[model samples]
Target chain A: MLETHDTKLTEDSVRQLVREEIQRAFKKDPAKKQACIISSKGTLDWAYPPLILATAAAATGMDVSVFFTFYGLNVIHKDFERKLKVSPVGNPGMPMPVPMPDIVSSLPGMTSMATTMMKSKFANKHVASIRELLDVARESEVKLIACQMTMDVFGYTQDDFIDGVEFGGAAAFLSEARKSHLTLFI
Target chain B: MPDIKEDVVLDARNLLCPMPVVKAGKQIRTLEDGQILKILATDRGSIADFPAWADDTGNELLEWHEEDGTFVFFVRKVEEED
Candidate 1:
């Protein structure tokens, strides 16, 4: 009888331990994970960082929001494909088959050529296109927010953006950023 | 190394950072609890990304190995309790 009573106590303790372990495993709330990013550049090369980071963060199950301000608004603009261009004139770091001086790079059609080369190079490298990244960001529910003040300054309307974009001002971005542990201005 | 039988195979070969993890995250959601996913990727960055991703999502990173130039990863899904 004593042995049976001791066994019952052991079983109860074991069950309690298992229950505690399960609770400990769930201590970190998934909903609390958040990331906020600000995209302030509109160049083709500049566009990738914010979108990539946002999508990756969303994929990791973190709530993500990206604020588009200044020229960055071009990323969410309907004509993003055409508006986003790479200018080699001022960017000497750009690799070229034949190096050209700033004067030559500033010549007509140079930006178009640089942009095309970058697009093809990225394509060859299997890098996701801006459009594809944007699609993934949208599908993953990453919030794309356009700054209302910048929109007004740039004379852009709500209809100028693609679907699923939210419009807000600095305070809106700050409110979200304050709650996020990871905040970046890219 | 013992072979792990995976319930799903995700071919992310030649894809860059974020795509592999992005695709893996998408695929893992389609699996039931305890199901294993096999991912093949060429991006070197995934060597660090996968483990962190698994930790963040509360999934299990069963094992990872480099076969030739390809990085192979096996992950098991862990259901979140609300």
Candidate 2:
């Protein structure tokens, strides 16, 4: 609040200015600075969003939490190299090194080849690798929550995940999502 | 162009979308409110990405320009009430 030497200034106008300032302040509420993302798909192509968004959001000072469930467990799994293979079969839109038919994409070693090609393409495009993004997310303090029920169903123990992974369930995720203004399922 | 100074500079050239913005965001936090962060990136997509990121993070996008093939942006950190 500053002094207004103008004789035209009114008391009601001063109150209005304060109200507007409060509204502007509320625009940056802490709740709005929260992001809760759910990772449900495990494939290499599908793995990027949750990690990328979580890391990106955290970089901007938002409190971020990523709940990994179902096949998404592959993202935090120790064998991510083998677990995060992109299947070329039935994915006609996926660009290929050579124009190959669907049958060729389904042949043995195709998934591994496709994953390798994708890794190289992403690297060439200067996109951060998934592992790098994961590291960034962790460094930025974005919570990595793995679903306990899914782990049990898939016969995965806590030791199967990388360090700093938290085990939780649907309620845990909802608790965070309910408090966050930004929620995503990817 | 008019003279505009920056508090810090980040070279994000060769880094793609999200990475440039992410690095800028991380660096901006180390600055005080109203301090400017200058970024250099080669990703054409950063033309749209930086402004959107600044808006999302409640920071002020002072200005942007291109130098040769690089996209340059200046952002001011907005200190939110915690």
DockQ of each: 0.72, 0.66
At residue B71, give the lDDT of candidate 2. Answer: 87
Per prediction, fnat is: 0.78, 0.75
| Candidate 1: segments with Cα more than 4 A from true spot | A1-32
Worst 10 residues of 2 chain B by lDDT: B73-82
Docking class for model 1 is medium
The lowest-lDDT stretch of 10 consecutive residues in candidate 1 chain B is B1-10
Error of 2 at A90 (Å): 1.3
- Per-residue lDDT of A1-186 in model 1, one digit per residue for the tens? 346546567777778777987867656643358999999999999999999999999999999999999999999999999999999987979998898999999999999999999999999999999999999999999999999998998899999998999999899999998887899999
Q: Which digits, one per residue and each the tens of the lDDT, describe model 1 over residues B58-82?
A: 8999999999999999999999866
Stretches of candidate 2 off by over 4 Å are A1-28
Error of 2 at A58 (Å): 1.2
